[model samples]
Target: MKPAINPNKIVVFTGAGISVSSGLEAFRDSDLRSVGQHEQLASPHAWNRRRKEVIEYYNWRRECAGKAQPTPAHLAIARLEQKYEVVVITQNVDDLHERAGSRDVIHLHGELRKVRCCGQHALVSDIGISPQYLGDTCPDGHELRPHVVWFGEQIMHYSETGRHFKTAAKVLVIGTSLQVDPAAKLPKKGRYRAEKLIVNPHFDVADRPYSYRIIHKEADSIVPDIVAAWLEGQRWDYGLGRA
Candidate 1:
């Protein structure tokens, strides 16, 4: 039999930057402004006023995600499962982490590879990057919408994600600027004594409470090395110098 997985938990919080290397554009870097005035295409207001535009925009995104493969950073995060119980909490809607072999992942912003009933959010179905049209409906015939947390919509699994951060022994925050709220507050929720690290090209603590070692580097350039060190029983503070 193989060795049992370690019970110690490692919570990985990711954002758009992690998937950028996979040929997917980060939200801030994408040409969403051209879709509508001020990104209205990604909001609930747009969904109500211009449903067709919303569907088409998301369909394009889903197609982009489908064509993109998981990056090295994604695979490195998945490899963490070999030594520890890993739980990924991501702001990205793409399924790259899952495609990279991560068994447990929570998408705070919702998922592009799934759809939910307009009448009942609980009724979710996997569509595997297939395009969602205006006429598609759930079993109850309620019009289906892309299962993403639109602008101003409440995030998914808030309480559960907080619990994971609060109890984790190690927290790895990668590729996120942590500029968004609710999810941005999660790293602060980690245990004060937990070993916390942030790997991003641009990130700021700006009064957050937990002790964090910040690595100012691109995720694809640095994350695999970090994973190798951790798996070899080395801490982030050992030989990794801060930039």
Candidate 2:
């Protein structure tokens, strides 16, 4: 179903599936060993302890994410931002959403491009291009660590994300299974005006009790169509802002 075109405030919740079109791998879709290895080696405890393994793992991720670009689906959402107050809450660690010209995106998973100090949560911009070597260090004299959330650790800035959800007029779930915590609860946490919309080809969140519209399709195929339909309803012409 098409969403109400005149939405004042729109919050889009995206996931790794959106990045898969850009040649990135999802942890659940690929071999478990690679995902687990990367997670273990990139964790705070691992980086503080087994520094070499951590650097190598994150360096690989950095290289991969660096080579990837945003998909058409990402661009479509950015276009929506022009007409509606759009705020993206994404689980993907890549900067594709930003590259697509999205203004305000909250990464539930930390970015792969940035680095932080080992002891403190403080991050540094623009750190890795190649695989990070053993001797990487922050300007503050501490070892540089990956800016990613590892297993068994609390998600950074969750309270801020919850606050964003509380203010949303509509919640759009794109390319996510909604199996993960805190993020999984965001749809239900919003006000009654909020309408949930899920778009995914694989598993979906339709079994849940939230008021939602489910579209079983790939992001690249459905997003442009969805946005096209949304735009046609407005008084503005179709090509108002083409990127």
Candidate 3:
């Protein structure tokens, strides 16, 4: 389905699947580790009981996310800014979208390239996803922790994101199955007149209060086509559901 383009207001909400083609794996999708490993490695329990292991896991994640590159989907979204006022709100912690030249991106899950002091929890530095040893200290002499949000941790940047969602005229969703919060909530409640399009490889496609569902397709394959067509002044005829 082709979506009409409105350069004035567009919000691109992205998820882990957008970066899968780039060689990074979203924790939920990969079979590289057992469920227990993920559970033990990503939670506060791990941080308290297995501090060393926790640090190692996040450091490994940083290395892997760092090696990954932006995919066509990311580039396509970045290019959209040339003709449209675009805001990219992503669930993935990787900086691939920014690396691909997208100017305005909101990392709801936090970023892998930064660290914070464990003392005051103040943002300490942008360490580019490098390994953070257990003894690493910030300027305030506090141990530095991965900036990326962990399971059981609170997500950042909700109010800032909500304002944009309420003001958007077009919302393009990619590669998510409405399993997560706030991210899932954005598409359902937005401006009274916004086009919401969801692109996912696996999802139960059904009509809802605010969006059209496009299923069984990867973002890398479909996003460029949609954005390109939009740039060329063409749109799909979905009739009244064109929000």
Candidate 4:
């Protein structure tokens, strides 16, 4: 018997794992690969302590982000919106979800493609060129920095994300360990625990009672099937083909 999407408002919360297949790495795994490096480069302390290096570091990542492509998992997730009211809440800063055609996407972390002024966050702009220099500034003369949510900063969309999570009729968690705070807790703190589905190879917190549908696999390979089953009224033949 094929499983069906619980007929409810759907929110797919994605993480770094989903984007890994697209050639991006988690901060811990990147070239500046260290917990210390992440703290230094991706933290507000680091941003303030070494603004020039931080800008250089993010510029390098942005260049890589610009070249990265959306994976099959991303494409499958995008297709879900056709049959369900899907909103993608992704931890990734890349535009892969948008590129793959998902219209309603929220970046939990601030984006890698955008640069912002230190003084005015409203002064954000796309980074069309690599190596944003020290001189890059807003009209107000504040330095332009990567619009990412550093360690000391609140996530890019804090209240909006929680409100959506609280009201979501259903949530599909993909390729995340559920280790990050606040976001990790939202799965259980909703108006309705609208049938939680988790797809990931490994998660530290598998003991959570609310998560019932656990598909332990990489997303691109399995997500399409789930989405397909949901769209086709729960008719799926996993080994045979579409039923």
Task: Report the C-alpha displacement of residue 241, candidate 2, in angstroms.
Answer: 22
| Residue 63, model 1: Cα distance from true site in angstroms | 0.2
Q: lDDT of all the models against the reference?
A: 0.83, 0.72, 0.76, 0.74
**lDDT by residue (tens digit), candidate 2, 25-103:** 6443685866778656756677568877777777777787788778999999898876778889888888899999999
Counted clashes in each candidate structure:
0, 0, 4, 0
Q: If both were scored by TM-score, which would come out higher, candidate 1 or candidate 3?
A: 1
1-243, model 1: which lDDT tens digit per residue?
A: 322222388999999888777888643376655445336787888989899988988888888789898999999999999898899999988899999999999999999899899895559999997888888989898999888998798999999998888778889998887777888898888776778888877777574445887877888988898888778766776244321
lDDT of the structure predicted as candidate 4: 0.74
Tell me the lDDT of model 3 at 177: 78
Candidate 3 ranges beyond 4 A from true positions: 1-7, 26-28, 206-209, 213-215, 237-243
Query: Would you estimate the TM-scores of all the predictions?
Result: 0.90, 0.84, 0.88, 0.85
lDDT of 3 by residue, 48-108 (tens): 7888887887787788888888999999999988788899998888899999999999999
For residue 203, what is the lDDT in candidate 4?
A: 65
The lowest-lDDT stretch of 10 consecutive residues in candidate 1 is 234-243
Q: Model 2, clash count?
A: 0
lDDT of 3 at 3: 39
Selected candidate, larger TM-score, 3 vs 4: 3
